[model samples]
Target: MYVRTVYATGDPAKIDESLDALRVEAPKLLADQPGYRGYSLFADREIGKIMMGSWWESEQAQRNSDDHLKERRAALLAPFAHTVTVDSWEAVVFTPSLQVQAGAGFRLSRFDVDPSDVDLLVQTFKNTVLPKVQAIAGFEGMALLIDPAKGRGSVGAFFTDRAALVASRGAQSAARGEATAKARVTMRSIEEFEVVLVERV
Candidate 1:
């Protein structure tokens, strides 16, 4: 699996509105892309920093999406690019393994599971959370890594920018209330991070 991420800094006032726009617009725009799969977005409240993420079956699919025509794709993304910085990359090693350099702006998440409910947890994440989150705006891609043998898992997303990352949640605001309640029932521990760079094997 491969990931790409982008973000922006230096603009605080425009942050909230931009993030919300990404949450609502991205999925509707990118859902039909040939190699498209799923994606996620996030925000760091302290600095008003944002991250946009997308996941693809291979690095090539991601590259092709970038080849998208500007004029044609503008309607899908016109709202999220107000004034944000952007970066992209692929994942190497997250925890148990060492990482290789692939690109920039990669995010790695380590999720702890309940020993007694490990299998159920994995199922819920795949069946429940994944579908709901993928529909959000600024969500260009997503990938989930699981190790049932060890009862642990890791998930990643590719982004366009910090604004997109922050706005991802907004894209699904219509369903946010219900999604939150469901997550509280299923998740054990969720950890979020910022990836500086990545290397490939």
Candidate 2:
């Protein structure tokens, strides 16, 4: 699978409005696109930050949507966001216990691995970290994305709600730390967000 992520910073007050717009617009724009699989939007109202992601069946399919999505993105982002960052990645691992929906909590963790150890890192994640994460209370799903050429990867873990998220943090952190060290990866950053919208095609 291929994934595209858009990060933006905007007016906190307008965040809900922006998400509502996306909730209405994404399906109309993406539902019939070739190889379109799903899409989701997350936000951190207090920080005025939002992340929008679209999933595709393949790299070519993802690339094919870029031109069509460009204008839509501009229109939605222009009024609210002052800073925007966009990235694409290959989905390495995805485990969804339930369909993604509003009210879910997400924790995004980024890592930098040695280019030569990319496969090892991925294997370690699947063999070790993932099982532990799945066993956590309220665990809902997880997605791991990587750019092998750049040795960069990100993990997105979801929970049923904020309470579940908080309850699992300590165990999640410990497992992730061990996995990263074993894989010779460097932990970069982590961010939290609330899922506002999701659609699977």
Candidate 3:
């Protein structure tokens, strides 16, 4: 599947309001679109970072979504967000898959990959990282998203809760390190978030 992630940042105090729209309104607006598959929302209330990933059956469908609800999206987010950004990626790896649970924990790791080595990097993720991540006690699922043209990619791990997310740090780090070295990709940022909602159809 192809995914489009909307990133919004603004008033930390209004974070909940922004998330509420995505959890409720945004999905409704997207449901009727062609090739729509699902939506997953994540947030870091402390920093007022809100990210919602919408899944589509193809790259074209994903691209279509960006224009499908432009007006409504702006209206819904403008009150709380000062800046909103969008990104699209092809899902290279989705293992076991991300489960939908309001309070689940999602840990996201960003990377700057070698454009020419996209396939090698994906294999490294599936082979070098997936096994270690799956071994974590609270692991639920994992996904790897890549933008070959931009040399950017990110991987996310879903956990049962905060404790599980915290406990799995060591192993996750080791696996990420190996993948980074082997794939010749630069690891960027890593942060954990609370899953607000996930709606699939």
Candidate 4:
């Protein structure tokens, strides 16, 4: 799968309005696009930050919808968002559970690994970390995306709600820390967000 991510920061007061607009408009605009799979909108209300991600069947499908996506983003988010960062990635590991949906909480972690350790990192995550994560209470789903050549990657873990998310933090942190050391990957940033919108096509 190919994924496109947009990160933005804006007025805290306007976040709800922006999300409301997105909830109404995004599906209609992207529903019929070729190879479109799913989309999610995440937000950190206190921090006034938002992250929107759309999944596609391939790079070509994402490229095909680029223009329309850009226009829609401008209409719904540009007015409120002061800064926006966009990126694309190929999904290396995707494990979805029935518990994942709107109202879930998400924890996103970015990593910088040595290029030579990319495969080991991916394998270790699947064989060790993922199993432990899935066993956690309220665990919903997870996805790992990477650009192996650049030694860059990100992991998104979904939980049932805020409480479940908070409860699992320590376990998650320890697992990630071990994985980081084992894979020789540098842990970058970790952020928490509410899953405001999630659509699977």
TM-scores for every predicted model: 0.42, 0.96, 0.95, 0.95
For model 2, how big is the CA root-mean-square deviation?
A: 1.2
lDDT of 1 by residue, 82-169 (tens): 4444334444322222332212123345554445655555456566655766665545444555444455455565444555555654
Better of 2 and 4 by lDDT: 4
lDDT of 2 at 167: 90
lDDT of 2 by residue, 63-174 (tens): 8897788789878877678788989999988974348679889999998989888888888889999999999999989988999989898999999998898898998998
The parts of candidate 4 lying over 4 Å away from their true place are: 97-99
The residue ranges of model 2 lying beyond 4 angstroms of the native Cα positions read none
Q: Whose TM-score is higher: candidate 1's or candidate 2's?
A: 2
TM-score of 2: 0.96
lDDT of model 1 at position 148: 43
Candidate 1, overall lDDT?
Answer: 0.49
Judge candidate 4 at residue 69 and give its lDDT: 79
Lowest summed-lDDT stretch of 10 residues in model 2? 95-104
lDDT, candidate 3, at 3: 89
